[model samples]
Target: MFLKPLLHDFRLALIQLHVSAVKSENLQRACGLVREASAKGAEVVALPECFNSPYGTQYFKEYAEKIPGESTQKLSEVAKECGIYLVGGSIPEEDGGKLYNTCAVFGPDGAMLAKHRKVHLFDINVPGKIQFRESETLSPGNSFSMFDTPYCKVGLGICYDIRFAEMAQVYGQKGCQLLIYPGAFNLTTGPAHWELLQRGRAVDNQVYIAAVSPARDEKASYVAWGHSTVVNP
Candidate 1:
């Protein structure tokens, strides 16, 4: 069980940008936020889930970008320019006719550090309240991802992955002090279980947890609850 102490100088920033149907604009908006975070003394800047496209699975197909592709290329440059570790939130990934919700982590030199394909897909139906099934379009990732940093090893997961404690525990057991999950929790469940689960994992594992969610946009097809949160244990 590796729960190392965090670096004293570590300052992480969570970017909460409103995503839209426009991909180019969305990327640019994220870039601007990255600069803002860097200027504010954030050594590691993280974005919210589905930062480049709409939160719905229907939009995933249209907006899905290939890994090591355009979205990544730009993110690499941004990380290099800012000289900071960058957590790319989650992007719809298109690989071999299969789509996955994936998040990419970039090193300070702009090199790809690690990529985590969401192992758990968000599939929930609240009857007339809310119904979303990511499994309809996204294939669950089979592996766990953890990357080393000057501060500590960071475990990566996407939205629904938060519901699972085993995954986070494995990361901590293997020597991870920080866990980050880029997510989009809806209005229905976000209010109820979002923070509860975050705090639960942190308290149980004695690790720092950060979960970033897209900014609330009621105008969009799927409205996100819009509370990007953090818990320290």
Candidate 2:
């Protein structure tokens, strides 16, 4: 295991956000939550996957934004205002005419620390239950993302990427003390494997694992499992 003998302690906060179809409202709510978390002494705060817009292939093109676009601009401003590290969660990113599920991290001074495009595309057909394919509208990211903080080294991933244990092992080998995944697991797969996968990764890597998800929205087309959790090895 890659357990560290000693490391600086830091408080982490996960925002189980209620996502909406409205982009501006989503950003406002997320920023408010980050400020609240920072006020409560959280050194690092995370938002949920697809926190800025509704989670669906149909909405990808409508909500997709460039890296330095409006969504990321709000994230940077909030991080600097709160004086805390902020994980901007997964947004539909538009780069070179292709869309990707991406996560951006910012430091206390609001510098862009690292950006991770989700490596694994969630393409599962559970027959009678649910059928979804991200590849239809989104492209996969190729690189593993890691960044250094005063508290620890952080590794990033998104929703379906958590299922690959090998990715967690690589992060651990690279000395990542904490792994953060902003995910949006639907009702079908969430109850069965969400927490289980997080626990498995944390134990195997001997690192803190934070799996964040958007709050369950019953009225929406895609209902997410609302448990945003942190697991300790």
Candidate 3:
């Protein structure tokens, strides 16, 4: 009798978390979401950018923490307990007095798989509407990053980073089957460009793209257009 190769199916949970000024509440909410996803048999859970804090650059100084800080520590523990891969969304990280918008990925074993900082900062200043200067508060990530999972090779990209095609092309060249982007785009661009850019990247790279955004916070300092979605190439 001949034996056949075995194949496995992978399930991903995209968490569109609503961010707030309270850190403890945000973390608790994320942990809860991870637990829920795990209960649903999700092998991997991807979260929205800045899931532990607000999205604006102005709040970077106040919320930034180190890699092994409280947020990552809590997320790692949750991943270990739930036995699911957790993409601990983007957060403000403090390094040598400079801040970085970074994403940390944890394995089911509660190990730090990979970390990718936002390279392409949002430095656009739209006249009479919105102005963003990420460089002013956060240092840009110098290198591209990807990690291996039981399901497939995964690539990481943040909000503004998705607009750059080079990053996705690099991931495609590396044989990544899925690219995850945790973003919180503003109304000025989110309404018109969010989905378009995500789909474009997915089609161009021929890979699945999962983009999660924080639910709209109209009363916050910056309002985000919430429409978290997943796209397949």
Candidate 2: which pairs clash?
none
List candidate 3 segments past 4 Å from native.
1-7
Residue 128 in candidate 2 has what lDDT?
92
**In model 1, where do residues sit more than 4 Å from their true spots?**
1-3
lDDT against the true structure, per candidate, is 0.91, 0.94, 0.88
Give the lowest summed-lDDT range of ten residues in model 3: 1-10
Task: Please provide, for model 3 over 82-188, each residue's C-alpha lDDT reduced to its tens digit, 9 standing for 90 to 100.
Answer: 99889888899998888999999999999999999998998988899898888888889998889898678889999999999999989888878788999989989
After superposition, the stretches of candidate 2 with alpha carbons farther than 4 Å from their true spots are none
Q: Candidate 3's error at 73, in angstroms?
A: 0.2
Give each model a TM-score. Answer: 0.97, 0.98, 0.95
Query: How many angstroms is residue 57 displaced in model 2 relative to the true structure, after the best TM-score fit?
Result: 0.2
Model 2, range 1-233, lDDT digits (tens) per residue?
44794367889999999998889999999999999999999999999999999999999999999998999999999999999999989999999999999999999999999999999999989989889899999999999999898888999999899999999999999999899999999899999999999999999989999999999989998899878999999
Ranking by TM-score: 2, 1, 3
Strongest candidate by TM-score: 2
- Clash totals, every prediction: 0, 0, 0
* Better TM-score candidate (1, 3): 1
